[model samples]
Target: MTHFDVMRRLTGPLAALMVVALAGCSAGSREGDPIPAPSTSSTAPTPSTVPAVPPAPTVAPTATLPPPPLDPLTPRPSGANTPKVVNVTGTVTAGVESGCLLLEGYLLVNAPTSLVYEGVRVKATLEVRPDLVSTCQQGTPAMITSAQRL
Candidate 1:
């Protein structure tokens, strides 16, 4: 064949192959690549470009009963006289300081070791004893006369 005839035949096939290869590469890149965000003069991000976040689920309000009154009683003049006592019923919880127990804001004192555990509901007879020295560092100190799990 003449030089011109050979050149023309080669160019047509080579151009068609190049176009096919470029189309395939462009399609793959379009699928894999993330779209570039539009540039803005303002530093603040555009609201449209930001993703929408779902709102948190609403929780129901819990009803809380008021804590019982813990008024201190008058100290007995003599050991022969009986001290005043009040009954308190509530759940036992751990104090912020270690080895301390509390019931309805009353620092439990003179309670049995077995009953000093946390989270146990109990019916207890307490005597407000503000005169006694305490190291529990929390709640009104009350002496437990009798206690039983409820």
Candidate 2:
């Protein structure tokens, strides 16, 4: 127990096992070379190096509407004009030349003539024929008589 205390306990456990084996051989060397292994598998995710998140922005589709136009004195039924007189040219939004006879009210051509120029808004049995409502003149160009169309 004394060859100098067993050479100082074998040089302090051989200098702590040569400083833990030179700190695990200087953590895998550069000065001692050798450390490259690591790659065990698992990678796949590269649609072009992946990191472009921009494919969720594009929406513009919705349009559908058209249907409304039909009204020209609405009254057909009873042989609906069974080959009778039904001229109907259309234009005179509302005339009234009453001294002899003229009372017109057309607008049945392309239809929708904004309610045929007010003869007090028509209807009263279509102004009860004051000789065809006087002669109905607001613009001019009629030919009327029944000529239904509604």
Candidate 3:
């Protein structure tokens, strides 16, 4: 036979063998599916001696998270609508609450008035009301309704 004819004869048998092998390999490519095998007896196969597989779990998983933390402890009054009061010494300066009171070491407290000079030093007993909207240097507001020079 010619060289081309010899190659053709081999190709037919090789192609058939490849198709059969591919068919066998594809039988078990899917997950959770049994691979088929040749069986001789017509009777059903006996159960394996291996232990039985337990059923899949039915309960769903749960996620638990801790409660959010509490807010910072603020200086609150004994009752509602009660104003915070304090007595501090500082130089008079302009502030949002009006004439701002500047303590030697403390943050500025609003004292808003022209009667006190820009840099006058004084010791004052002041009644500071709780201001929800005032933005002084400190977190609180001090309204010095009464004052006396030291």
Candidate 4:
């Protein structure tokens, strides 16, 4: 080839190589800013381009309950004091101390004289102190200060 043809060919390939190299260098930088270095900090913040993770869930609240009521006339079975007159309804289970009849039937009655009676069905308005009613169970024998069979 001639000198002019050789020079043209050389210049064309050199210009193309320079353009490719310049394109790669420019890609590493923003419009006017420098490229950032790799982070070394253990807690380095993530780039804003990435999405953030969400937080965990929580539990709801609850309510509480109240206390029970009190009764006065019902005597503790283990105690010595003879119970006052109280009307009860239960089957005749056994005979208790004193003249108590130990009603084993549906209704039970406790008289002031330490007498207890068991009946299949007993309806008696016993003269029981209001304070002792809370301790009485459905079938518990109570001291019947005054009782009238219904």
Candidate 5:
């Protein structure tokens, strides 16, 4: 027989012998053998023997007051129909975004073309409009109600 045929003949017997040897190694308690009890130490208690702890009591949530605004502008009187107008005095500077002007951290909207130039010192009256949509991302959005060069 060729070497390949010889190998094929031995492969089945070799595999069967290996399986039998592995089965013998894995064999544990035989028939009629008494089962061994679980080992225990007196120093440490078993999980089932330990007593359960009582759960913590639940707490009711309390109402909290809202925080005050951070802006320095005067607070509006309670129940006012109009937003509070604020006066800002500072040099008008170009914002990081194009077509945006800032004065004292307030982005100027509807500002006159003359007052929109950079480095122009001006006194401007503004109404803070947090609801207004703006492309000036660097400062708070405020509408320029009035402005004058100083």
Candidate 6:
């Protein structure tokens, strides 16, 4: 068969592929450059022929997050005359004091039953009882005197 016949068959399909590739890359072109139509005079695009499309202003991917919540470890001044009352607010996880705040269907420490589940928001009055709290958790320990779900 003649070489021209082979090239004619290949060019028809190859030109269609170029049209699709150019469409994806057209986003970076000038305001009024005419998209070249499929023709034998123009060479099929190579990687270099397609102007570099300085990738979609590569937005460094971000994660979904809430505004920073109240820190459970904020410090406050202590005076001998002042009562030790801690107003701690945080997500109450399944582990309270690292242990489930409930046992056998009973909520311990007067922790509201409705709020006993994990990840419940709580604002509670923690009475200072340093002796009963273990310092290993990197925070002070106190009894839950009262709590309100926020």
All models: lDDT? Answer: 0.78, 0.41, 0.57, 0.47, 0.80, 0.56
Candidate 5, residues 8-46: lDDT per residue as tens digits? Answer: 999999999999989966775566658644456567778
Judged by whole-model lDDT over C-alpha atoms, candidate 5 comes out at: 0.80
> RMSD of model 3, in Å?
13.8
Question: Rank order by TM-score, top first?
Answer: 5, 1, 3, 6, 4, 2
lDDT of 2 at 25: 69
Model 3 clash pairs are 98-112, 99-111, 99-112, 99-113, 100-111
Backbone collision count in every prediction? Answer: 0, 15, 5, 27, 0, 0
Q: Residues 1-150, candidate 2, lDDT per residue (tens digit)?
A: 669988888999999999999998667544445775446686988699889877997878687664332233554356532322334333233233432212243322222345343232333112122112223243322233332323
lDDT of 1 by residue, 5-120 (tens): 99998999999999999996676434346764446568876999889999999998799875444333434446533555789889999888888899998888766778657999
Q: Candidate 6: which stretches are off by over 4 Å?
A: 1-83, 96-112, 133-139
Q: Estimate each model's TM-score.
A: 0.45, 0.18, 0.32, 0.22, 0.46, 0.31
**lDDT-sorted candidate list, best first:** 5, 1, 3, 6, 4, 2
Q: Per-residue error at 17 for model 5, in Å?
A: 48
Looking at model 3, report the run of 10 residues with the lowest lDDT sum. 67-76
Better of 2 and 6 by lDDT: 6
Compose the digit string of candidate 4's lDDT tens values, residues 17-56.
9999999777765455576644667774568856776776
Question: Which stretches in model 2 have alpha-carbon errors above 4 Å?
Answer: 2-4, 11-13, 20-22, 37-150
Pitting candidate 1 against candidate 3, the one with the higher lDDT is 1
Q: In model 3, which regions exceed 4 Å deviation?
A: 1-81, 93-101, 104-112, 137-139
Locate the minimum summed-lDDT window of 10 residues in model 1.
Answer: 67-76
What is the C-alpha lDDT profile of model 6 across 1-150, one tens digit per residue?
A: 899999999999999999989986866555565875445585769888788767566576598775443233443346433446656766665434455453222233335567555667777776654433342343344556677778
Residue 11 in candidate 5, Cα distance off native in Å: 43
Sequence-dependent TM-score of model 2: 0.18
lDDT by residue (tens digit), candidate 3, 1-150: 899999999999999999999997877545544754555576754577556889998986687775343222354445644555578777765444454445543333434355455577777766554343344554354455556665
